[model samples]
Target: MSSSTVKTIQDTLKAWKSLVFPTFKVNDLLYFFLKAGLAVSTFALVSLFFYLSLSHPSFNSSSGYDYKTFKHLVQQRTIADASAGAEPTNVSHILFGIGGSAQTWNTRRHYTELWWKPNVTRGYVWLESEPPEKENWPETSLPYKVSANTSSFKYTCWYGSRSAIRIARIVKESFELGLDNVRWFVMGDDDTVFFTDNLVTVLAKYDHNQMYYIGGNSESVEQNVIHSYTMAYGGGGFAISYPLAAELVKILDGCIDRYSHFYGSDQRIQGCISEIGVQVTEEPGFHQVDIRGSPYGLLAGHPVAPLVSLHHLDYVEPIFPNMTREDSVKKLVITYKTDPGRILQQSYCYDLRRNWSVSVSWGYSVQLYPSLMTAKKLETAFRTFQTWRTWSNDPFTFNTRPMSENPCERPLVFFLDRVESVDGGETRGSYVRYVDVSQKECDREEYVPALAVQYVNVSASHFLSDLWKKAPRRQCCEVINGGDGVDSAVYVKIRSCQASESLTPP
Candidate 1:
């Protein structure tokens, strides 16, 4: 090569190195600034997200408060003071009317089955504006004034049937009359008979500070049904607190239009109250006594017995209808020895058949005993053995027994056999050896014999009664009596037996 060409190439190489090396330093500075800016931006975004999440309105520190404190706050907001014209004693009894023939209304009166009347101060009836002209209308006493409103009929198809509308009208009228002070609002159909005297006393024992809506019975709603909420059976003798009623009325008045297509008044009320966040206490004794095949003859240890108001009105001939109001009331008046041995033998075995893995054998033995049997069985036995015992011995006595039979003069006896101990210690055996019999037995005397029994626990009896009252017919077998050492348990099992034999009316 030539010397001049070599010098030109070296000059070009020197110029290119100076420009490229200087630009490389500038690119490094730019990359450092870009990475630092991204890190700072990420930190700021995360901090903002956490702050917003913690400070949101729905997220409150109050959620950590104890249940008692939260409940107190709710009570203060919902319930009014008894002295502030919100006293439960202000009104008594919520009268319900079932829409049907006049004969149905007459049947209710003849039965004298409105259980809430004695507990409440007044009663009201919901009826069609015009009375049905029927042959069976009673000639004597009619307790309630009939109202004639058909606005309820418009939603009949949606609510339930015509009978449900009748109950709704009665409820609406009771509310309109400012009967919220009435502690127990007994609502049900005409066919029902509420006869328990202990209902008011039982309700009085619960803390009245909180607002509650008690239902007589509940029914499941079909999944495919269209409405604001699924329907429940508020028709059969349901009671609600005045505060709950007020809240329900507000919701009803507001949402009635949107749910105009919904027909049943009970359903509408249930939906409205539910939306307002009122929970339902389904007590036993509240019943829907439809005359499908036979009538429920006796009333013994029925849960709703204390708060019952009958519903679903129907009538039948004296002979054809084996069970009469008099017969039921008579059973309530009698006191018979409930044989524990028999109760165990006849009592339906619920846990034994279903929950054998979890339950102890003793629970099974107690649940099926004569005294702890199904409601129907107890009722029938009481009715059949009415002559065997005296009314004075009954806890809730109102009458005496016939002179021909031994007046259940024997003191209540309880037999106890020592079973396993809690810590596997020595077993204990005891029995109520003797109890003095007396005519004036309604007081301490009545319960003394039963109380004397070493094996029988009053609390256990009450618990069993409560379970029998709340459970459905077939479901009664699951109830257990365990106070000695075993924990109370329930089991679901299928029963192959048909309904028990009907009780004979005296």
Candidate 2:
């Protein structure tokens, strides 16, 4: 090695020694360890916080699965074990099995479309066959499914159509679809108009996990006698809980054969459910509309329960006068959208100064009697409709007052005209007087003042959905402003009755 290279190597070694073995004080070492400990402790605490957040029952996750969903799925157990199901029942949870046939669906689809909110509502309209090749299926309507052949099933009821067998199987096919999150199976005719929000309100009252057969019987006593009064009249629509549906589908095909002599599909279903030992849980909102004429009397004095479904619409007069059946239903739907929980709800109060009794059927009509009437008499429906089969006036599910021949004896009727939402969750509905040319006007001085009133304005708070969770009670109304005998409009307010309030004459 050259002497110059050896000198350079020696200098490099001395410099490297100085850099590697640089001196450190005791305080410096202690500070370094302290920082390291703090970092490790901080990391441990952060990890623990994250773990606790994920594990907590009340914690909600926006990123992926929720706590209840995760626990229900991963742990394979129900949330709290006391919940109605995994969650509150919604439109999606109730699977509607609409019984329709190719022959009638074309016309009946109009009724189905009026209430069917596409995408938001779940289920199919089960038809006997594909619709006509010439007509294309509209995306706006519910998707159609051809029902499985039921020709092999025994159906021997001489008066009943064989179609009842096919319709009864809709429940079976709907269950077989294996849709997720279904808690209730609701069956309705294609022509039946369902107030879906109110239907949910009704269904949510019961536990979906339990076996329940929930529906209403026919309004006509004769029809109820012909069919089983214990059975739910299917056209009014009926809800079967998921637990009940699970059991029903298992024996439905055999049940059909067992009940071959039954006259209606609803009767057949009732028979099958009877075998399972579930009784009909009657809800007043389901109306079979087994009346032959106007349904005005029936709806005006609706039961305290929310209106759920109305069936046999084609057999009755249009709900509103001077409108087609479709238009009348649509009109009611408009008002219904304004206040679903209040539709067909009857509220009445007396105008003592004016000597008038006012009955308000929220979102439907108002009846202003010129003279004071007892609450009991006002609550009873007028006999504007007749028995479904024989058109007799004698029998109905509810008490009815016979229409007085004298025009002065009856109250002046007003029909809903317009409804709009107000600030602070209130609704304002205006009703116009409904006058028939065939009806004679009373010339009595007592009737003159009431007849002069052309408009009825109703104000009410938007109904709370949770109110149905509590006991059902008829709400009360007050005449906020009876006209000064000059203005043609009168203002009424519908409100929840106070704890001590009662409808007694002052």
Candidate 3:
């Protein structure tokens, strides 16, 4: 063989040996660095997670939150703590304390089924005329059935002139029959429309054992001002706990004589209630929609609170302004018959102004957006809200809409799993796999579109409730940025894991 060929082959073999196997020392040193890099990455992720949990609870996945990595933190508190108001103990609840005029049966008959008949589960309709001895009233819409039987109350006060003051007698008469068996006594005029679902919810907030005179104020400042702000307007209806009802019955007779000069039954009742030292604890749902103009104004700004009753609806302006009262009524039936909740929310949710301010501590506020991502008790830069307030004095109002979709409604902070996509105008991201953040089970691992300054109101009362049944989604608004940094997003716990079944009424 040629010497030149052999020399080249020898050199190639020597070079290939070094390439095939590096010295152990060199390889081990290189391996150490690779392992160190991996360890550092793991440490950083752990620390990031820890920081999110402790210091800043809410986080935007911008620092690296993705749908797969985002996990919803388990709630620390139980559902019972969140729903302290609506806990249904062993008490049997009652439905009504209806007060109708004896002289107006013919005129009132049409409205009887419209309001009280369909909604009331159990209670009496106290009428001026002989209470229907027959278990059923003449047929009405949907043929509303009476859970509570009707009974007439006898009174000496003549009709027309003394009709407004008759509630006093009605109260005494109702007291005469013993209401100690029931927990709540709901009072309303025959024409008043009551949303019993909301009424019950509002009542649940307070202890039945405590004297709760729950209701709302009148539209007229003069009326509220003339009477003490403590009085709940009658048209909107009012709730009295068993204890309060028992107590009020005792003083109502004596107080009625003193307030008899008042123009209407409502004021007289208010006077009696107030005299008993049981002032009206306001629940915005009991609206006094007594204005002469369009109901749209009143309906548009309906409170975020549950609706107890809409009084004088028969006497109020057209529900749909510009239409005849009859036409408005027809439209209202059509509008609300299918989904009353949506209709009510539509009436109230739209046309809200940002006159109110809410604080968000942890969520990222995009460029030029209002602050977003507040928890139930987030201490925002504004030292914002203690528990989701609408204005300075109002926790909720028709004029204000809260961000509902963000899971930060609870005081717990949340972190974003990651930004899945950013479209410049809007950012698509996934929050941690939370128990109640996603409204739909389908959307749990999905990417959600988010933007800054756009406050969105989720109608859900709480996140956990959204899972089993339809919850009230808050009004739609914008999300701002986290106060801390661009990488940060609000990490929050939506609600306790406890489901609604836990609070089932006894």
CA lDDT, every model vs. true structure: 0.38, 0.84, 0.46
TM-scores of the candidates in the order shown:
0.42, 0.83, 0.48
Tell me the tens digit of each residue's lDDT in model 3 across 331-420: 443433332332333210111122112321111111111223222212112212221111132222223343345442322222222232
Residues 240-327 of candidate 2: C-alpha lDDT, one tens digit per residue: 9866876777678889999999888999999999998999999999988999899999999888889998888899999999999899
Q: Which is the leading candidate under lDDT?
A: 2
Q: Could you give me the TM-score of model 2 versus the true structure?
A: 0.83
lDDT preference between candidates 1 and 3, better one: 3
Candidate order by decreasing lDDT: 2, 3, 1
**Candidate 1 local lDDT, residue 387:** 14
Candidate 2, clashing residue pairs?
none
- Weakest lDDT window of 10 consecutive positions for candidate 3: 347-356
Model 3 stretches with alpha carbons more than 4 Å out: 1-92, 117-120, 131-136, 139-160, 179-181, 321-343, 346-474, 477-506
